[model samples]
Target: MNDPDFPRRIRDAGGRVTAARVAVLRCLAATEEPLTPDEVLERLAQTAGPVPDRVTIYRAIEWLAAHGLVRQLATVGRAARYEAVEDRETHAHFQCRGCGQTRCLPAPPPPLPPLPIGYVAERVELVIHGLCAACRAGERR
Candidate 1:
């Protein structure tokens, strides 16, 4: 899904518009699930058109995440993952310890207690780890 707004977002975020940037944003926009850096590179290489190198994709991911266009999620003992924040609200992520499946969960309750003075909250991310439905079902069998 080539998104027109991706360009505007890049421009608005003071980022240079380039093919690699656009391609990376497009790749993120096309998926709802978070992607690892390696996965992103594999996806680009799998396409028919010319693909950016792994270094290029990695840089793009960093730039995009820094610009607030993408959200980065990292869980304990797991590689970092990223998801494009287009048309999606802030929320948590859940990963199944049994099957290693990850999915987005609803956001934590808003109006959270104030942070300590001098500490500014830029973003909040929570990770809930547990067995998923299928895994739970399988465990019972």
Candidate 2:
């Protein structure tokens, strides 16, 4: 999502684009998989200036998610991962149980078959979990 105009788009959506927000957005944009808040902070620290605290980062992530700039992945543990949404590409993720690795699967999301009559669909999320190739190979040993 190398849209140079992303900051402007965010501002147009009634959100402020701060340095911290931009850093976090950039970190997500550079990755293919969702990243937890801690991973985001570490990535931000490496690229951006000083790293923001956990609470601050979490708050920023929540705000960004609310504004549709990012989407949070459902987690089975303490930390939740997030990814940017501006790339116009939609796909599901597969979490490997054996290795704890999260991989982005290229399969298309299920069709939302139209509502009966007056109902409307807003958002949908589908996630699949299993052992990835590496994890399965390791298990065979």
Candidate 3:
């Protein structure tokens, strides 16, 4: 999805407007589920012609993640996946153990128990794993 305000968003975050960055962000924004670097490259390649090189894609992913523009998810037996966080913050994801498909789920900040002194939390990743609707239906039949 080509978000019209992407350029401005990048600028507001002190990043220069560049083709690779824009393309990568658009790729991330286009999908509901997070994408791995290889998947991102594929998406970009299918769009026009040669996508950014592997190194460029890596850099773009790192940059976007560092800038809080995307969220990174590392599930078991899968390369890290990235999802655009342009809209909301602090949500959960549902991962299907049966089909390995992941979906975003909205959530308010979860209540937490008191923590020990001198410890702070940075990022929260919540994944609910089970059979998705289709997978569950397949099991039923």
Candidate 4:
């Protein structure tokens, strides 16, 4: 919807707020799990008002990621996923191998291991892959 906080977040990140950007951010924030660009487009399409094109959605996601408003996740699949980077703590993710559904886990990110000389660590992302409850149940059936 029309939360003023979305635009405010965009402006605070030093980027000009646009409809596509606000819509994309809002969609991500509304969901507990991360979503691919295609998923974002689908959700936006289901909502009221005009929906941005694929290119516009991609550009908006790129801009949001560059400005730290969204975080591009490291995924196993070809399509990259993104999640809103709000005040949430650094946590791990659980990706269902069967359904490809990714959700945030409550565990904290592990500490970085020692690196070689002149090497710098940016961030750590841990994803545990397994069959979710539904998938596992289906396997038993």
User: What are the Cα lDDT values of the candidates?
Assistant: 0.82, 0.78, 0.81, 0.91
Candidate 1 Cα misplacement greater than 4 A, ranges: 106-120, 134-141
lDDT tens digits, residues 32-122, model 2?
A: 8889888888877776357778788888888888888898876466578899886676787888777666767787887877788988777
Ranking by TM-score: 4, 2, 1, 3
Segments of candidate 4 deviating more than 4 angstroms = 114-118
| Residue 41 displacement (Å), model 2 | 1.1
Model 1, 29-141: lDDT tens digits are 78767788888888888887889888888899999999888888866555678888876567878888886667877656456688899999876767788999999999999
Estimated TM-score for each candidate: 0.79, 0.82, 0.79, 0.89
Give the root-mean-square deviation of each candidate in angstroms. 2.6, 2.7, 2.6, 1.7
Residue clash pairs of candidate 3: 1-30
Model 3 residue runs over 4 Å out of place are 1-4, 136-141
Better of 1 and 4 by TM-score: 4
Output the TM-score of candidate 2: 0.82
Writing each residue's lDDT as its tens digit, candidate 4 over 3-110 gives 899999999989898999999999999989999999999999999999999999999999999999899887787588999997978689988888889999877777
Error of 3 at 126 (Å): 1.1
